[model samples]
Target: MEIFKVEKATLSSVDDLKAYHAHIRPFVLQRLEEFRETWERGDEAVFEELVFCILTAGASALMGLRGVEALRPVLWSATAEEIAQRIHFHLYPAARAQYIVAVREVVRNELGGRLKAWIESWRGRDTRRDACVQKFKGIGYKEASHFLRNISFRGYAILDKHILRSLHAFGVIDSDRPPSTRNRYLAIEQRYLTFAHQVGIDPDELDLTLWASRTGMIVK
Candidate 1:
């Protein structure tokens, strides 16, 4: 991890980073393929992944998986307390439950349950993320990007804290603090996307590497 955060860690230019990425390319591709297989399972499977992203906002991706396991069967009808009792996230369980249900309803009503199609129809990741934030009750740009990337979308970058921290460590961004506004978030995301191109890795693939570089795990 110090390879990224330390100023003298060996990578001083995009070409140097590309050489490093080439060394780890096989492992990164393996993890990416794992993510792709999950998305390839069809719409129902993909919606479940979106729920994972929704549950993960302001939380860990690993915890999100557990929360999804606890709430999956009851998400559409369970009481807020019931949903809340199943997980250990920091936020109010009732509000999270409300947002979950509201988002489900919004997705069903607006996109007729075709989340993947809706995402694919957008001309760019930014537009797709904006639409997700507008339509879903609890989804912000990070969650939106997360959902899109989990579904094997090429153009999106999941700017979770792990990713932001790694990017800062690698000098892709100025600081590790979360972006304070939508404009700031987009600007930061653009930096990440540019870095992805420089490394010759897809945004989604680079996202996982950035995360792995920080946490030593190739998580979703």
Candidate 2:
């Protein structure tokens, strides 16, 4: 099957964000507002944002937040190694300690023993989204999407189960199997980018809105 390139659209300001929000369902619009509020509050530090993304990968936002809350004490009072140890122990009971450790190592190595440095490096990178994601540990397409969407990376689209289902239902893509590999995910990502352009919204913003709507946290 051939996938054609989707023409990109431009959105330049807050007014653009609001206008795009208005075109979505009320539930989706409400969630976009909520996500924008929450995302704006914690986007000050890129490393912290990435760490939050790592912790939340494969988990719902609420669940990820709980994990972040659990690690906050260590984040405040301990070194990175100490924080890693505490998180390793804390998540051990949940059987996800290894993945957490993997992510910690990736961040540590990529940042050159300093979290701040890693953030700087990430912000400086000019590679494609998938290439950037490949540099991180335990971060495949889905995890990468979760991380990128939260940070509002331009032109990136997330492909979680709900989003995939929604896309299929809307006839945006025809697929029987879920996106479980890099190539498959990229294909779906292309579809999502097309849908976003057609709907006149940023792909990442659209993802946030969809997540919020599906999770039922779209406030009136």
Candidate 3:
């Protein structure tokens, strides 16, 4: 991790981000530690995190958290229709429900209840992310990166609109528009990584900081 100097900021947004980050740094660090601890809690816990990412497809992070909370009882046991019935808050509840059920079945029957082993077997973060995108129905680049980040992977940019807007505002990226393709996402992700290095923020920490600036909370 390259460290950059954080002298007095010329940009007010950047200055405000730094100020807010300082105030919530400890809390944010704690949340990240919890995310890391999820890996040790076994397959069920890891799958819960994956379900959270699935629920976040077209919904807010808060909604994702709520969906996971709502579905926790039958997440591994419920049918798609049952899952959809429980998903009242998500934008595309039915679609996300189908995705969750299908992915869970694949993990259990085909992968032998070893989702973590399968994920770790992929080698690097990008390769693992790509493998996820290729294997899962509802997972795109953003969702895959989000899942990896929640599971304690570092430096993978979860390029949601809030983070994109921050990058554009700070001139790290040219536009706030979400990337439309794998190549474009990777290109923007590279820009984000470079900006994180230049601004002296860990890419993961900057993700939550920018997200909290918009949503007022630093969640998974």
- By TM-score, the best candidate is 3
| Candidate 3 segments exceeding 4 Å error | 1-13
Tens-digit per-residue lDDT, 1-220, candidate 1:
0112212124456665566556666777776676688777877777777778777887677777778888878776776677777764635566667777787776778789887777678877577778878878878888887877777776776777877777877788899888878999889988988888777777766765556555656667
The whole-model C-alpha lDDT of candidate 3 against the native structure comes to 0.84
Error of 1 at 72 (Å): 2.5
Pairs in clash, predicted candidate 3? none
Worst 10 residues of 1 by lDDT: 1-10
Clashes of each: 0, 0, 0
Top candidate by lDDT? 3
Put down candidate 2 lDDT per residue, 162-200, tens digits, no spaces. 677657755788963568777787778888888888877
Every model's Cα RMSD, please? 4.7, 9.5, 5.1
Q: What is the overall TM-score of model 3 with all chains considered together? A: 0.92
